[model samples]
Structures are given as C-alpha cells and as structure tokens.
Target: MLDAPEVEELTPPVRTLMGPGPSDVHPRVLRAMGTPLVGHLDPTFIDLMDEVQELLRYAFQTENQWTIPISGTGSAAMEAAFANLVEPGDTVLVPTNGYFGYRMASMAERAGGSVVTVDAPWGKPLDPADVQDAFDTHQPDVFGFVHAETSTGVRQPNVSDLTAIAHAHDAFVIADTVTSLGGVELRVDAWDIDVAYSGGQKCLSCPPGASPLTLSDRAMDRVLSRENPVRSWYLDLSQLEGYWGDDRSYHHTAPITNVYALREALRLVAEEGIEARWNRHRRVAQSLVDGLADIGLERYADEEYWLPSLNTVSVPDHVDDGQIIDRLLNEYDLEIAGGLGDLAGDVFRIGCMGHSARPANVQYLLAALDDTLEIETPKTQ
Candidate 1:
C-alpha cells in the first residue's frame, strides 16, 4: 500500500492588498463566502440568483435585464463579452493603449474577429480623434476600449465620446471596466456603452469566481441573432440566458459562494451609494499620490487620465523595483505590484481600491515605502 503523505494545516499570510486587485475583501463579503451553500438549482438558490442580478445591475448602473455574474473570474466575463459579440469575419477594433486591450484583441480573434487597433501610447488613454480615425479606416463591426486600464493606470477620458463615435459608425461599443466598475465612475446606460464587464476582486472587494457583466438591449439582440453560434460553448450568452434569463434553468452549476459574496459586496455599494464610493476612492487615492510625491516618486499617468483605483508611481532611477516590492511583501506584509508591458521596470503599481482604500492603509503603505527606499539608498557622501 502506498504511504499517505502528511499535509500541514492551511495558513496564508495576512496581506494588505494594495496591488492592482483582489483589494482587501470587506469583512462582510468574506463572511458571506463562509456561509453554507444551497444546491445550484434549489428554489432558495434560484431566488438568490434573482437578487444577485438585481444587485449587479445596481453596481453597473444599468437597467439591462441581461446583467449577471459570470461563473468564473474576470476573464470569463471578458470572454463572454467578446465571444457573444464577435461573429466570424466580424471586424473588431480594440485599443492598443494597455495590457487588457491586447487581451481583448486575442479574445476577439479567438471569437473569429478580424482585429484592428486604435493607436495610443501605453500610459495614455485613447484619444477621441484616434478612435474616430480607426473607425473611419477599418469600419469595424465592434469596438472595445479599456475604461480603467490596470496595466498603465490610465483611465480613458471622454467615454461617452468614444461610444458616440462607435454608434455613429454603426458599430457596437464594449467597455472593459475590470479595474473601474465599482471603484471609479462608470455609467453603462447613460454613457451608451453597449456592453461592460468587471471582476469581483477589484473595486468590489469580493473574491474571484463571480465577475459582473451587463449588455444593452441592442448588444443582446446582436448576440441572439448571430448567424453562427458563439465560439465557446460555456461562454455563449444566449445559452446562459437559459439560466440567468427568465427560464432560470441549469446551464452549469453556479458558483454559489461567489454569488453570495458578490451579493453582499453590491449591497455595500448600495448602502454606501455608488457616487459616494467613487468619490471616496478619489479622495483616498489622492492621499496616496500626495504621499508618493512627498517621497519624490512621480506618477506615471497624467492627472487628466490618472486612474484613481490603480496608481502607477515612477520608480526612482536608483531604486530596484523588485527589491522594494519584495521588502514590502515580506517585511511589511503589504502588497503592491510592478508595471507590465511598455511600462515594466519604469513604474510600480500601487492600488488604492475598495476596502483597502482607507486612510490607515494608505499611510501605512507610505511609511513602509519610505522605509524600503531609505534603507536601500546609498549613504550620502
């Protein structure tokens, strides 16, 4: 008989998540996740499903009946958006401004889209003129842009203008709000965004596995009328409608715990008031920026498009980013991340989001960062 391997009891570090996401989960949401689960198709679970959808609508600021939480992570919701909307040979325009834009292009192509780009530097938001020029040149069937880009810490300004441009060109608009949905200002219906998707681990301060997604009626109509079925069987919105829509039938076993956590998280949003939450993020992140500036760290993104949820601080020429990051994690139990793509090695990504956005966390981060940099600095002559 094979010997049984001895395993230790589970213990994870208590981390202060000031990174790009999975920001400190609210205590209430964490408690919800620990509650006993109901069978996915049980009457009680079905009623909970209705509550989840309603709460998601409130968080996304949409009246779309099609709003629901995808069963997996943010990427699942992202794939659902692209797979449902991009048919074979469809011309899909995606921004080249940040990391998630590249992800969008890959998903669109996998969905049988012919991808094209609207050019912009990594740390800058898509300019209206560039987007318009891309539409005029490519005449894309669908256009996708990042509303709050995590990689570059740039918030796309003039979102309504971008949507208007897409509509005028007779193209559908999809907004990537993974980093913005609950932390920053986003209005799906009023802004005329055709579709939008987000992760629970970001501003929602909930664990991963249930991501928010919503679609306007026109976008849903296009998905329902697709000549070819969506590329991925699991992500097909029309079939998902069987479960999330009026039928409330079984598509796949829902992530009951994630749904519970998301419901509680969105309830916090309603209690706090969405606009007030947005302002709180702005206020808290402003403190982070002020502290960084005092320590001689400059912001990578311009103020006009700076994402309040994710702040990219330029690393000092003498400071090794990896060293500082490790020290913060190991010594301070604080978590912040490094930049990606074009900005890698040039900046550190410090997130002030959700439950982690409190003043105490920000001040703690600043003090820890100050110590990390000071210890590593060379002795003055």
Candidate 2:
C-alpha cells in the first residue's frame, strides 16, 4: 500500500496583491469562507444564492433575470456567454486591441463562429467608426469586445456607440468586463450590452473560482430561440438558468464556499454603496498614477482610455521586468504582474482593485517599485 501523504502545518503568506487579479481578499470574506459548510441545496444556502443574484444585478447595473455566478473562473463566464449566444456559422465582430479582446475572438471562433476583427493598436480604445465599418462589412450576428482591456489598461469609451451600431445591424453585443465590473463604471441595461461577464477575483475581491455572468432580455430571447443547441453542455445558459433561477433546480453543485465569499464581497459592495466604491477606486488609482509619475514611471495607456483598476506602467528601457517583479516578491512580499502576450516585457500591470485599492497599499507598491528600479534607473535630480 502507498504510504500516506506527509502532513504539515498550513500557513500562507500575507501578501499585498497589487497585481491584475485575486486582489487582496478582505478579512471578512476570508472568514465567511471558513464558516461551516452547508449543503448546496440547504435552505440557508439557497437564500444566500438569491441574495447573491440580487447583489450581482446591483453590481452589473442590470435587472436581467438570468444573472448568476458560473461554477468556474472568469473564463468560464466568457465561454458560457458566447457559446449560448453565438451558434455555429454565426459571424462575430471582435476587437483586437488587447489580450482579453483576442480571447473573446478565440472563444467565438471555437464556437464555430466566423470572426471579423476590428483591429486597434494595443493601449488604445476602439474607434467607433472602425466598429461601424466592421458592422457594415460583416453584418455579424454577434459583436464583442473587452470593456476594460486588462493587458494594456485601456477602457473602451465607445460602448454606447458600438452597442448602437450593433443594434442597428441587428447584432447582439457581448461585453467582456472581467476587470471592470465592480471596479469601474458598467451599466448593462443603460449601455445596451446584451451579455456581460466578469471575474470575482479582480474588482470583486473574492477567490478566483466564481464568475458573474448576466444576459439582457434580448440576449436571453436569442438563447431561447437558437436553432442549434449551445456547443458546451456544461456552459449552456438556458439549462443552467433553471438552477440559478427561481425554480432553484440543481445543475452542478454550485461552488458553495465561493458562493459564500462572493456574497460577503457583494455585501461589502452594498455597504460601501456602488457610487462610493467607484469614487474610491478612482481616488486610489489617481494616487497610484501620481506616485508612479513621482518615481519617473510612465503609463502605457493614455489618460482618456486608461482603466482605473489596472494600470499599465511602461518598463523603462534596459530594465529587466522579470528581475524587478522577482525582487518585489522576494524582498517586499508584494506582487505586481508582467504584461501578457504582445505587451509582455514592455509593461508592468499594476492593479488597484477591491480591498487592494487602499491608499496604504498603493503607497507600499510605489515604495517597492522605487526600490526595485533604483538599480536600473540613472541618478538624477
């Protein structure tokens, strides 16, 4: 018989998460996760689920009946939204601005969609005219883009115009708000976004297991009327809706612990008030920018298009990004991320999301960053 696995005392580092996601989980949320586990279908748990759905609606700024937490991570929410909405052979207009935008295109393609991309340079917002051109060119059945491009810290300002263009063309607009949902301004109903999905880890400050997904009435109608069933059985929104809906049927065992964490996090959002939370994030982000500038760091994204939650700081020439990130981790016990895909090595992705958006955390990051760059930076001033 195989020997029993060795056991040891469990301990984890107290990290200051100033990176892209899983931003420092609040102590209250961590405690909520430790509460005794109840059965997924227990009356108390079901009540919690109801509250969770309502809170998600408040966060997404939508009254859509289908809003609920998906079982997997943020990517699962993205997949479910696209798979349910885009059927085989559907044309999807996607923006190619940053990593998550490209991810949307890839997911659509995997769902058998013929993708027509509206290309934009990294660190820049999508142009409404270019989106209009894509609509004219493809007349796609679905339109999708990342509202906040996490990789480059760019926020799309043409959401209203883009959604209008898609609506005029009779196309359903899907939005990736993974990094923006609770950290930035998002109005699912007012913006006319048909489907929107986000991760709990970033702005929500929950663990990375649960993802919030919402579909507008029109998007739900499209899902119900799809000629072909959604490709992935696990991600079929129409069926999963029953479980999360008032009927309260079983789909898969909902991530019970994650549900608890999310509920607490959402409650905190409620306690703080949505508008206040938005203002706090903006204030903290401005402080971060000011501090970085004081240390001679430049932001990759222009101010008008910048996302307040995730800031893309340009890596000074000749500085080894990996080296700096490592030193930050080893010495300061803080974490900041390197850029993804094309922007890798050119930028450092710093985040001011959820609980990590406090002034103290931002100041700590600035100090550590200054120390990390001391060697790479030349003496002046």
Best by TM-score: 1
lDDT of 2 by residue, 1-381 (tens): 999998888887778999998799999999998988999889888888889999999999999988899999999999998889888899998888888877888899899899899999888888999999988988899999899888999989968998999999999999999989888999999999999999999998999888999998889999989898889989998888778877878877888999899999999999998888888999999999999999989988898888999999998886888888888988998999999988988999999999999999998999888988886643232
RMSD per candidate (Å) reads: 1.9, 2.4
Report the lDDT of model 2 for residue 356: 94
Model 1 misplacement above 4 A: 1-3, 377-381
Cα lDDT for residue 261, model 2? 93
Using all chains and alpha carbons, the TM-scores for the candidates as numbered come to 0.98, 0.97
Per residue, candidate 1 scores C-alpha lDDT tens digits across 1-381 of 999999999999999999998899999999999999889999998898899888889888999999999989999999999999999999999999899999999999999999999999999889999999999999999999999999999999999999999999889999999999888999999999999999999999999999999998999999999999997888899999999887878898889999999999999999999999999999999999999999999999999999999999998888888889988999999999999999988899999889998999999999999999988654223
CA error at residue 231 for candidate 1, angstroms: 1.4
Root-mean-square deviation of Cα positions for candidate 1 versus the true structure, in angstroms: 1.9
